[model samples]
Target chain A: MTADHLESRRREIVLAALRCFAREGFHATSVRDVVRESGLSAGAVYSYFPSKAELVAGAVAPILEALTGVLDAVVLDGVRSVGEDRTPTEAVAEVLRRIYPIAVGGEVDYTRVAVTAWAEGLRDPAVRAIAERTYGTVRGRLTDRVTRWRDAGHLPADVDAGALGQVLLSTLLGFVLQHALLGDVDLDRYATAVALLLPRG
Target chain B: MTADHLESRRREIVLAALRCFAREGFHATSVRDVVRESGLSAGAVYSYFPSKAELVAGAVAPILEALTGVLDAVVLDGVRSVGEDRTPTEAVAEVLRRIYPIAVGGEVDYTRVAVTAWAEGLRDPAVRAIAERTYGTVRGRLTDRVTRWRDAGHLPADVDAGALGQVLLSTLLGFVLQHALLGDVDLDRYATAVALLLPRG
Candidate 1:
């Protein structure tokens, strides 16, 4: 097959897997589910992705990248330099804004997969590796931001940045869980409440 | 069978299901898994709990009651008369204190089950019904508290109680998720961060 044919086939497989993951969850779903969902033969599916782990990884990679991209846009790029007078809540508001669309507003619902990944991570070793890495990276970035905020005098000197960071990340993760499971979970209101918690400039 | 014997057998079946649910997940676990875990025949299991739904409900009712009890301890009973000087953070702290042992300290790790319930609720209609009621009730209580705080002048007049309540519930839910999955998540630090977020006395 041509290179374009191979790429298209791979995309088709990944999309099919995303659907199954979103509906049945990453761990509960099997390779056969992807095969059945794709309307492609098991052999054809296997030829592209070797196993269930690889299949889920393949399907989830883009969503992961997109989620990271959203975080990077807010946490990494949205932060102003020290003494520039940026409130932590402002960056947070941006993060939630960028997250809402990706979490539930797409052809593939990322948070739905995310909620499963968090749950399945407790029991599935393979899935746990992915979850731990992602969670660690996210938490580390938030911690660094919190430290930066404190250093810049946006927050008090005695504030525990690490603890604050964990709670901050938890709030976001909690929002994703609620939004994924409950159809009408509003982000704007949550964001407002979060802003109230942060120190105003 | 004697009443005591029948009750004991029912408890045995429910306990078996809880183990399976924690290991696999409520939506993913089969009644056969419960039977196998119980070391009892399928007939014996069915005689106690007619179906998977009823089985999970039986398994989770106590945990649910316990969770609500924690909430009630803080949100319901912990609240003092208007003009009584209990900070919102104090009530939150008490709730966290009560919740720690129940969520991760016990023989049955409830937050672990809770994480799965949130994920499984997305697709399992039967599970979804239970989840909706739980989340709806929790959010409603939090919202009511926010309104009470505002009305009592604990919070500002302009604060959006519904949104604040949602975020408040999210923070707690987020704490549960982290605690269940990460194994070393410090509720004390999280509680501290939560305390920082609430209005100071």
Candidate 2:
């Protein structure tokens, strides 16, 4: 296969694997399942993903990468999602908005898959590494944002930015968990709710 | 067996099931595995749990009940953990302190098991029902506390107590998710961090 063909083919297999993993779970899913899901021969699936573990990496990496993409827009380059002048609550709500797709949008809700990844991470080191990296980045970005909020006078002068950031991260983490399970709250309502707890000025 | 003997025996089986479920997962565990874990015969295990599904209920009910117990003491009977006059942040912190063992302290770390339950909840309706009832209770209590905070002059006059309450629940839910996965961030630090966002006066 040509280079483009190879990349796209790999992507195809990963998407199929992700669907299976998300719909079922890591423990319940096998490479055969991925093969059947992909409509590709077992040989073709095996050529790209040697085992279910590789398929897990294939499925989980992109989900975490997509989260990083949102962080890139929301945290690293605040210009993409919202302005520096926006309140921390607005910025957070924007982050959730951008990640709405990953969280609960589309046929495969990656947030649901992300929770599955958390469960998988408990037993699998590779999944653990991928998840751990994203969480670290999440915690770091949140902590930085809290510091900026304090420096910008959005939060109290004595607020512990580090811990507050973790709490913020927790709030986001909790949102993901809740949405993944119930998916009852829409983005606007969630934004309104979380805004009450965050800095306004 | 006598009624007391049967109850203790069931309790023993449930504990064993919880351990097995938490260590591995719901899909991975079997009635025989729980039987082995309980060191009881399959007949006794079956006599009590009947099946792996029942064993799941056997395992999950107590965890939820324990959480409800904490909420009862912390919310309905606020006089137990902290005074009603305490700040909402302080009360939330008190809730975390009280539930520490359930979150990340104990050997099984019900929080971890809770995550597994969440994973199982995706596929199992029984687990979902038990998990759902607790979440509803949690949301209701948190919302009630927020209303009290607003009425008691602890929050802004214009704050939406219902929405703010969901945010608070999200924070606690997020705390549980993070603790289940990372097991970092002690309760005191978490309390300090969340206090900054909530009403202190």
| lDDT, candidate 2, A66-126, per-residue tens | 7778877776555333334565666677777787766566668787787787787777778
In order, the interface RMSDs are: 1.5, 1.6
Chain A (alone) TM-scores for all candidate structures:
0.90, 0.87
What TM-score, to 2 decimals, does candidate 1 have? 0.91
Clash pairs, model 1 backbone: none
Q: Quick one: best lDDT, which candidate?
A: 1
Q: Cα miss at A154, model 2 (Å)? A: 4.1
lDDT of each: 0.78, 0.75
Clashing pairs in 2: none
Pick out the ten consecutive residues of candidate 1 chain B with the lowest summed lDDT: B82-91
Q: Which whole-number lDDT from 0 to 100 does residue A174 have in model 1?
A: 73
Query: In model 2 chain B, which range of ten residues has the least summed lDDT?
Result: B75-84
Question: What's the lDDT for candidate 1?
Answer: 0.78
Query: Per-residue lDDT tens digits of candidate 1, residues A45-142?
Result: 99999988788678777767876888787787635555664456566667788877766677788888888878778887777777777778788877
